[model samples]
Target: MTVTSSERTLLDSIDAQEIVSLTTSLIDAGGENPGDTEEATAKVLAEHCRALGFDVRTVEVAPGRPNVFVSIGSAERPGVLFVGHSDVVPAGTGWTTDPFSAVVRDGRIVGRGACDMKGGLAAVVAAMAAVHRAGLADEHPMTLACLVDEEDTGLGIRAFVAESEQRNYTCCVVAEPTDLVTIVGCRGAANIEVEVRGRSAHAGQPRNGANAISAAARIIGIIEGSQAELDANPDPDLGPATWNVGTIAGGTGTSMVADRCVLAVDRRLLPGESAAGVVGDLRSRIESAELTGSGIDVDITISMEMPGFLTSVNHGLVTTAVQSVIDARFIPNGRSAGSTPAPNGRFAGSTPAEFTDIWTASCDGGFVAQQMGIDTVVLGPGEIENQAHRPDESLAVQQLTDSARAYALIATRIAALPGL
Candidate 1:
């Protein structure tokens, strides 16, 4: 698709420095999970959106947590929605600099949530502002949803979905770290807890007690064996479902036989799998095991579950997003927009390629796509593997600038389509 003069003007209006500055301020605001600081982040975002001549409001999801909504153009029509989370994981130890300082070193923004995903959030804000400033909002309406509690249990998105039952939206774009790729599908996730009970006795006479730890071990073995079965039937895009034994605890002391044991497991699901069904199947398997008549009791429960989503690769949103990235990479001056200068003064990692892939990790996008029946695509600025939740988390400055341009184009193209 060719870039029109109006779209070119809008893209050129995206200020790189402004995006970087806002990203730094957001990182410095410090909305860490397990902490009540998302309010601060929401304030910063609302203030900025208001300054851009847009309608901004904050809806409280909890006592202190709020989701910020920024609107451009009329609410009567179905618009493009940009979804993002304001909360970031807690910054653990082993950093050479302050985690909240928002340092810019070697063309990268170093901070706690720079990559996953304050940078992406800032880019979305910048894109919306640019579109509004270009006098295109009336034709290309847009909304920015800055959510909360995404790192923990997804309370903010749930609240938004509940209130949005009567609202109209064409599609959604979740601003998560995807290394600039368009993610068409993501794996769902669930946390399961298992408990085992047996008779307790002194270790001096092992045969006098039914060992609970031994019974738990048998369940763990079953879980490990199920992985092979899942691997045999993998999804074409999102891959196979798998199980992980995250944590396990049993026994009090070596002098006594254990009577109780607990295990925490993480399960990744395919698009059509349900957490309840998976749990039921596992319970049935455990009940039918040899331990059923061996004087042992077993219990299973699901602590959390997030659904997965799959969008067609041929969808207009996906193709538009890919083209937007390609267009954003080339400027009028024939120089790549997001090229980083190497130590020897040459460009390093300049050209941006189109990559349509799937995400193994779950996100708030699943909730929007599955619950609201909206087509959702995850695309953002940073690399999740090396940048998210690490000691010195950071993202490239050029990526932020390019992402803003790409998002602006996506909004314009999607809104202009007929029968959307």
Candidate 2:
């Protein structure tokens, strides 16, 4: 396939308002699973893909886990992959309107997945529509893949990368809530559970028994105490990796020194940090603690984890995204027709090529970048602060439009990919 300016123009000509509606509707509908908001979203995205006249396929990896894939060009062609999860995190409680109801207020769209993702999904649809409207389909091929299970676990992407043998592509764009910044890399995390064993005894003679809760507290001390070491050495982009003692459970009753204590930990990691290294170090820390006569026991198990990944800013995806953003925001050191101060339709820098980019923390980007060997760029609409997940989670109208434009341009540039 060849490239043409008319196709880019067509993609650029997409209606931003419609894109917002499309996204809002999906958010309002919500998905079924923790990641796949609704199975309908898969069908909706498939329709969008088909409407653009692309060859689309849906892979139901698990019982209800549905992943959609559409290729605009042949697999042999150099292409760009736009990857996003069709699923949205669950809407827990509290809301100005129904969490699934697309409420447009003060020019903003509000819903559960409004900012966390649906915003990006809608923009993807608009971008697809643009390629068709602009006739870009005739020149280049781009793959828009929407997967399920990015929220609960990255099973969808994990499955796609594992199940699909012919997935080699040039680069990838993930529509996460990064406020349209080009996020290159970020920290990974480990979700672990620790259990402490002990003997049971009556409160009157507690000294004769082992107190699991007490032993667990000592473990907490070791874990929390280790934070100083983690904080002291921070990654440039992701900053200092931190550990949080999230939950604790132990003992049978107040009157007895009952056995069994459990603690849930959330550990965030930076670049150069490995799970084995972190877990081993933590285990060593626990072992090194003197608990000879404490009458307590301990054990730990990994619950979940996502790895950290980075891409070079010099990579074609990174350079093109940054250049596109600079051109959209700063005066081209000059002026152009219809050029005025509007929302900067550009992505900030952090993803794609692992160069000098600053990603704030861990996300699904970790899975695509590290697990699947796909260079992931975190770029999307809305501020990271506002994805409040309740009490009216929202995405600014302008943010949606801007992100849609950025995705459109990035998709175009990616379709015209360079050697990976």
Candidate 3:
């Protein structure tokens, strides 16, 4: 299938109504209950794959959660992966609708995961479909890796790479919502829990026992001081790393002298830094602190290790995607479409018209870039600010349709590259 400029325009002219219906259907896929939303989400995706004549399969990676993999191009050409997560961040408090219910109001698909990722997922599939309708699969290979559990953790993507080593792909395009920015790099994420212990003391007796809060005071100092080191090593484009004592618990209500304290530490790592090393540093800080003398103990454990991703601007994937975005948004390409900002205020203006910067957030692309060692970039539709884990997350109808067009253009060029 040869995709010419005419083919690009043809796919770009996707039915807005069809996109809204798909969005509503996808939003209704109530797989967010700690269960595999994959079944419902995959059902929608599988139908698209089948209609487009691609090989589709849902591999059960977990008990109820499954990872969906679809391939549209033949094995003869170089394989490129398009990874997207079907799961969304849990809907928070105060939603107007049943979070799962995709309501159409104000010209947007409103629901959980509509912006953070479900929107991206729908757009990617539509892009794939557009590629098929334009008959461009004959020249290039495109694979969609829709995994589960990206909202709670990135293990879904990790499991996919570990389980499926069957096909080797040279590039991965993760459809993470970046508004319109070209994200070439990301900061690593580290989740650590620190604990402290002390003998309970009566409120009336001042010297009877040690105060756990007092013991924790030293621990806090050590952790806070570590910020300098975090900042000492800076990450390009994204400034120096940072750490936060996000959560702290001690004392049983306000009436008693706390005997135990726990610290939940959040550390954002810069490039060239390892998640393990960051944990070790925090551990060393805890041990080196003066809390040990006061019967206070420190425990540091890494709950999550999300590695950062970055490829040179010159990488074929980056070069291609950035050019694709610029052409679609600014250059004389077929990307001059109009879209309104999400319900929340995360976007600037209604449509994309410039080379926006990458967002500071975690995405499955982080794992693919680090785990798969594939040149990756996070590009997609919808404004990100109002969409991520918000009470009201929604994507404009036009944004969904236009993002599909942009992605299709990129896929066509990728598949038709001289040698894969």
**Candidate 3 Cα misplacement greater than 4 A, ranges:** 1-13, 33-38, 204-210, 253-257, 329-356, 415-420
What local lDDT does model 1 show for residue 136?
82
For candidate 1, lDDT tens digit of each residue in 184-262?
8999999999988887889999788888899999998888778889999999878899999999898887977888899
Show the lowest summed lDDT stretch of 10 residues, model 2.
346-355
Residues 1-420, candidate 3, lDDT per residue (tens digit)? 233567547565566676677777778886673555667886887786787688887888777677888887776666668888778766769888888888989888888878867777777777777667767665656788888887666668878877745466767877877775667777777787777777776788736766777767777787678777657867657777788888888887565677888888877766567778877876666666545755556666778877777766655666566556544443234333243232223343522323435447767777777766677877777767757678888887767776776677677666545433
Which RMSD values do the candidates have, in order?
3.7, 4.2, 4.5
Residue pairs with backbone atoms closer than 3 Å in model 1 (clashes) = none
Report the alpha-carbon TM-score of model 2 versus the true structure.
0.86
Model 2 lDDT, full chain set: 0.71
Q: What is the TM-score of each candidate against the true structure?
A: 0.93, 0.86, 0.86
Scored by CA lDDT, what does every candidate get?
0.85, 0.71, 0.70
Ranking by TM-score: 1, 2, 3
Residue by residue across 1-420, what tens digits does model 2's lDDT show? 122455345534867678876887677567845544457777776776687677889889787667888776556665667778777767776776888888888988888788878888787767666765666654555677788887666777777767746556667787777766677778888888888888999999999899888888888888878998878877665678888999998787899996888998988877557766788887788878865346776777886777777777667777766545434333222443133332234223343332124665567777677766777777777766657355688888877776666666666666545565
Specify the highest-lDDT model's number: 1
Error of 1 at 334 (Å): 2.7
Pitting candidate 1 against candidate 2, the one with the higher TM-score is 1
How accurate locally is residue 126 in candidate 3, as Cα lDDT from 0 to 100?
A: 75
